[model samples]
Target chain A: GIQVEQSPPDLILQEGANSTLRCNFSDSVNNLQWFHQNPWGQLINLFYIPSGTKQNGRLSATTVATERYSLLYISSSQTTDSGVYFCAVENIDQAGTALIFGKGTTLSVSS
Target chain B: DTAVSQTPKYLVTQMGNDKSIKCEQNLGHDTMYWYKQDSKKFLKIMFSYNNKELIINETVPNRFSPKSPDKAHLNLHINSLELGDSAVYFCASSQVNPANTGELFFGEGSRLTVL
Candidate 1:
């Protein structure tokens, strides 16, 4: 079984501030995804970067598979972005393709 | 149209009751999954089904059973529910390919509260 750990378990920032969340896994992964759970509890897919880097609007993510870690950046965050960010990975060595999720980083953006 | 949808967006029941949550995906994906998110917001995979066949079954209790009637639908049934069974059950789907494992699309989630 693989392990996924997220850093800065809790975070708070002003509406215009920026932040970065980190995720570290214990094994090589074939699939990695970043998700944002909104305040209403809806899970929104943020990125599916198994490797390399990708950006969507004010959000960007980079995954260094060789290093077994990934970073998610939110620029000029908004109050609507306040919620939980989760990183999930499916180990390359595992038989099942279930994505193991990190505990998540709770973000609170205050206007 | 919603890509993935689960019914009974919210459920409240008493202990020892039986309940079921139904999930359907219109993305034409081959794999579907059920995930449980606890009160603390910690999400974990409970079951995974690929094309109507069971592929992954975590250490979930026997009371929790997942049934996939077809490739596009997966449903979860829980019996003798306990207080610990109270959580947000999410339905997700993805297409698996050799080149890349598909990204998952989660439903709005079904929140179950046991009394």
Candidate 2:
């Protein structure tokens, strides 16, 4: 089983601020995804970057597969961004199977 | 439209009871999974089904059984529920492709409280 570790287990920021969250895996992965669990407990897929970079709205993510790490950035955050961010990975050996998730990073944004 | 949906968004039961949660995905995905999120928010995979066949069972208790009646539905049944089983359970679905495993779409979690 591949190990996924997320940094800054807890975060608090004022609205309109910027922040970055990181995820480090223990092995090469064929599938890497970032998810945001809103206050209502719905897990929303933020990114599916096994490698490279992508951006959507105020969110962006970069994955360095070779380095076994990924970073998620949020610029000018809003109260809606307050929730838990999760990093999930499927190791190469997993071969399209279930993804292993890291302990999430809880984010609180106050306006 | 909701890509994935789970019924009985909240369940509260007593010990020794048996309950079931139903999940359905309309994304036409080939794989579906069940994950448990504990109080500390640690998410762990409990079971995965590929094309309605059991593919991964992560040492989950025998009391926990998952059934996929078809490619679009996977249901979880838990018997003799204990307090430890109290947690939020999520249902997710994804397309399993060699080139890229598509992003998993998850349903609003089902919160189970075993008293």
Provide TM-scores for the models: 0.98, 0.98
TM-score result, candidate 2:
0.98
Q: What is the per-residue lDDT of model 2 for residues B1-115, given as tens digits with 9 covering 90 to 100? A: 8899999999999999999999999998999999999998888999999888899998899999999999999999999999999999999999985435578999998999999
Candidate 1: tens digits of C-alpha lDDT, residues A1-111: 899999999999999999999999999998999999999999999999999999999999999999999999999999999999999999998734788999999999999
**B111: Cα error in model 2, Å:** 0.6
Clashes of each: 0, 0
Q: Tell the DockQ for candidate 1.
A: 0.81
Q: Report lDDT per candidate.
A: 0.95, 0.94
Report DockQ per prediction, comma-separated: 0.81, 0.91
The CAPRI quality class of candidate 2 comes to high
For all predictions in the order shown, the interface RMSD in Å is 1.1, 0.8
Chain A accuracy as TM-score for every candidate: 0.97, 0.99
